[model samples]
Target chain A: MSEVREPQSDERLQMPSDPYSVPLDKIDVAQPHLFANGDHWKYFERLRSEAPVHYCEDGFEGPYWSVTKYDDICHVDSSHNLFSSEPAIVLADPEEDFELEMFIAMDQPKHDVQRKTASPVVAPQNLKVLESTIRERVCTILDSLPVGESFNWVDRVSIELTTQMLATLFDFPFEDRRKLTRWSDVATTDPEQDQSIVASEEERRAELIECLEYFGKLWHERAGNGGGSDLISMLANGESTKDMVNKPLEYLGNLVLLIVGGNDTTRNSITGGVLALNQNPAEYDKLRANPALIPNMVSEIIRWQTPLAYMRRTANEDTIVGGQTIKAGDKVAMWYISGNRDEDVIERANEFLIDRPKARQHLSFGFGIHRCMGNRLAEMQLRILWEEIVNRFDFVEVVNEPTRIFSSFVHGYAEMQVVLHPKKA
Target chain B: MAKITFIEHNGTKHEVDVDNGTSVMNAAIDNLVPGIDADCGGQCSCATCHVYIDSDWVAKAGSPDDQEESMLDLNPERQPNSRLSCQIPVTDELDGLVVTLPEFQF
Candidate 1:
């Protein structure tokens, strides 16, 4: 079996000839082109209705089950005992030579312990302390925007702000903060497809190893000092994680987890919020009328964005979900993006309404024990940014459609050109 | 301001003065109370901030609404006086209020 299935050429990937007439087996949702070309929602909509628990005989990694319905996704996410997260949590299995074993991919006692070690960083007390710093950063970014001049919002705003926050969380060197963004992009981006992100697997590993080496120095310093509260210091000194340094790979795994955890979700959501607001001008007008809606609007943006589309789980035992029997060792991807758009669970699911009731009830942050720990932090970042945006900017006009990321897992934008208009003082 | 006491399952107590409109979950979060995870940040979505209202304060904290009731139903340790702390808004009437945290909150 092939390890990495290179995507077919674009000519073969045009809109399916009778999307309705296409046989169920011919429908492979793992096609990266569908995501890159921004045509995945229609495919997922068909799948959710036609085959909620459909099994794709040939996925990018291998054959797997696609749990598309909201309830079924919840069933899969909650039944962690039956569907283990170990080995890897994405569609592609970790490379045999350079495996990553983050705690999110672990089960039971280990997952709980390691999660507790990092949870304090996102705890509300800490978030409250970080809020002012976040606002200051947001102000600086907003103020520095090239007024009336078009620029790539993804790099100028999303990546910069998220990278700065990530650096603050790790207490990494401020000048080297962009390295955190690079490592985060490297951790998730497919080196083969996204050459701009990373050219090759060897280069990716070398860059990641560089990340490990840089953090290793901080580990020694933090391990020796009286232990600060940053994530690195916490991991270096926590009762459960203190000895992780001895296991270099595991330590690297956690670093990748924290960096990516702090990076993509917020970054894309920030960019996504701007795009959503631009796409739905009435919602933007409503937001402009009443900034109190920012909190709820932030939740809606996250729901609409649904960054990190699907998380994969390996079946530990044969289980039947929605009349489909997933055999042992089969990978099952809970299509959270589909579930977030499922009309059955969410009222008016496809519409982007800022005032939607139960706005926070989406699968974007995931569910169960493995729910995104940085969820509050992500929401806060969006909430604060919007608050700042409404206070200062008259509008952020989208120049054109965004260049979408070419990955099924990371449902996000690669770049978005925008022109900013500021409110006159 | 209202004074509320959060009691950990292990018998540790933390007292904080909270503004009237603030949530019990926010008060606990503000004071860094150990067990109130509040993972959803007072959205009433996650039940990580589950707390059992002390009998004396149950009348003031009132019952959780339907949305909170459904969320609390997911918690295995939920009790009759149980409320998702994020759903309970602090007020002058709730002064001297006490809520006992479930050990599972951590």
Candidate 2:
């Protein structure tokens, strides 16, 4: 695994921060610092106007194409046959020794089958069953927050609510719920990009192994228990996945997928909504005036945050997207973050509008088969949180600038200080 | 013009006059019909526009193509007559076309 790790190039380290100052060919949006500093928007804007289907030959994660336009992203994402999601979905190749098999990074028959087996847990029908439980949890978390003092909303509200929801989904032990949050952070955290979560790749691997062993015990207890609706039981009993327990790595891989899928994405969005509303007070006022806009505001927040920045797909055959000829075996990134802000598709795309029409029609949840399975679940959680919030607090005020996450993959905040103002009776 | 009828999951009916080339999904969305989301617009990518073709109109509305099938197959709530409304183009073959929208888009 150490031998497979590529050393960072000095040129990449010294690359200019300004998008316009650098040559068109020198633009590499994959750099983690750009996103960390909130400087990615200008870079993507330049690429969208000058070179929508831009390519970087010498990136830290090797060469990859950036699909920046909204329609072009749809084309790449929908054409599953032309571009395959194999090996991994991030720009960096998976460690050869620790390669894990998960459905989102797979194509065709296998992807469809495994996804079908696990998706029922978060399906709309099941979400209806989970709604009341989620509201109850949301209320408790909100009620516990200190109203007068400023606190890190990311840790207190965002992380706590999402972590609790994930525990309920897996029917996991309520006491060890924060373990889910740690594993989720470790799963997506690249030590090269951010060492705050884990000191090194070896540490990341060790923590994930610990997570596998923990869930393995649960799998054993539930494998033959006649199939409960919880995710672990479904995977343990489903026809295609029942044998997954025998394959430790495969079992671990699916566990990480479900964990991170349910965790980091929603956690960041929850935090992002508070920050967005604070930044645009008029929109916040709109939300306050009519709490009915909560559902629509949820969609707008997801689009604005775009929790997971982009998904990487390797081209199976030669393809043409946005007038550029992408060769076979090229890495293509469908930049959902950029696409969600595209002016051509989304009118007045830059501004944050809670009442935006056709709010659900955004690329935040990528289109095609690999589209987010937990989208409805995420929306429900946000909807319920905001609904309860409006019923209680006058405002969830962002007291200071947020410290953003240091990864391009997880587009979110690390910490945000916010003070809750109670509604005047 | 083709007259299309969309039935909600609760049995409410909506009838609209659609242009010859417009899709059933667009017709529903254009007329402010409650059920259809059409998240991917007219593209057959997302299965949000899923609808059940009436038994009488099944033959004329036609079966899903390969792309549509790939999307629809992922849906757990899909029924025998399930078709993505985005894939069905409105025409004058039979004016009184009716399709039922699923309770949830999934």
Candidate 3:
């Protein structure tokens, strides 16, 4: 990827086609099983070119239509009535549902009201109130890192800040915050599907009962206190209409979503930005030389990494998209992975240009109604994060090819061997 | 300079003089008016700068558009007067506008 390909500028860069015509089974990178193999982008590129609106019928991880075009993604994402986040957001399959419910998964009036319940916490006024607290925590995490020593930046830097932020949001005891982070990551990334984190597949229902009982106590206690310092307190006080009666699982699920949803996704963006910078010395130096550019650089990194790869949506009605008709009840996964590199909207789309005027315009957070609710908070975390990292680290590099998590939905680095050379003490 | 009045949830009114072409949200924040966050840096994304408009100035501010209306679904108490301050441009017509901020936007 380092060697920039040169061609006549007149022609737009496009996905190559011979590969898209291949049978889904025969297609490279089609199986979720191959997610570990890496090089998934090769197949993504093929499909993006030949069948921008192609369906993956023999999908091992998905049989849904993969919508890769930027505009098409916007169309599907913006049309809340046409495509519902309900029926779930991940591309699991025909029959599994998680115990959690989220504003991101609800549509219209319900999604609207549900979003209000948590919006106060994310609203600028609220987040700004927490800025100093967040910065202190960010500094605490950074201050704890061994100076001039190699460490897993992902664990110490990315995860810690976000997890701690979630802890503050839940007002959970700090020592136990990591447990919440783990539960969140596991609940979301478990592609095995329909299995509660608490139980074996054999007694899944029984296990959920136990898990729910334990969590329900906390939910009620928080609600019992009638809301407190954290978001749980806010939701407990905010009115949910007649439709939301006694749904502890849904309420608890929302807590989980807020934690992981805001946690790893932005965490990955930070790690990805450092990895990209460390790999591209010129870009890093470009940033260090112009500290005024940190905010824009953060945007570029999010555009480039697009930490949360794709979110699934089910069609409420049949609609034609990208020259293909999607039947009602069919599943469609909008791969943010492909959309970010889209050639049409972005010139030299594959390349990361730090000064790109439109870096903030990327659909990485998504577009329209269901666009990420935590986007501002995520940016606040990332911007201040990069401000610190760019000032402290003189040099950083990836020592090994990072191993990715197994799930197709989460494109995250499990282990990134990194070496960070500290700034002169 | 233009006059901008901020009505607090408790019914306290703090008025400010603002330059033309500034966002009502920006003017509120610039004047240190109690409750505007402007978190997204005025990207029209974060709904933190929400305010309820005084009906007298509704014509000056006009109605919330689809984008603003949709975002309002995320505000704490939905009122017919709900509008994201960032979306309401501070034009000459809005010179005498009165806006109320929720007790707390968070």
Q: Evaluated with DockQ, which candidate comes out highest?
A: 2
lDDT by residue (A115-161, candidate 1, tens digit) is 87888888666888999999999999988989999999999999999
Error of 1 at A362 (Å): 0.7
State the lDDT of candidate 1 residue by residue for B8-51, as single tens digits: 98999998999999999889978888777665556665677889
Q: Judging by lDDT against the true structure, name the best candidate.
A: 2
Q: Write the per-residue lDDT of candidate 2 for residues A1-425, one digit (tens) a residue.
A: 11144676767743456899999998889888888889999999999999999999888778899999999999999998999999788887877788877999899999999999999889999999999999999999999999989999999989999999999989999999999999998888876644457788888899999999999999999999999899999999999999998888888888989998999999999999998999999999999899999999999999999999999999998888899999999999889999999999999999999999999999988999999999999999999999999999999989898999888888999899998899999
User: What's model 1's lDDT at A191?
Assistant: 74
- Regions more than 4 Å wrong, model 3: A1-30, A33-35, A93-99, A191-214, A224-226, A241-245, B1-68, B75-106
Give the Å error, residue B40, model 1: 9.5
> Clash pairs of candidate 3?
A120-B106, A227-A233
Query: Order of candidates by TM-score, top first?
Result: 2, 1, 3
Q: Report the lDDT of model 1 for residue A344.
A: 91
lDDT of each: 0.84, 0.90, 0.71
For model 1, give the RMSD to the true fold.
Answer: 7.5
Structure candidate 1, residue pairs in collision: none
Off by over 4 Å in 2: A1-3
What's the distance in Å from true for residue A252, model 2? Answer: 1.1
- Residue-level lDDT of model 3, residues A1-425, one tens digit each, is 00112332442222234444456434533334335455567677767787888775544444578888777887787677788888578765423433456677777887877776776777666787888988888777776777655678788887888888888877777887777666656555443333224334334334434545655655567775756757767676666722232775576557556766778788788788877876677887888788788877878899888887788889988999988999998888888878888898678878877777647667787765676777778888988877777667776667777766665666676667677667777
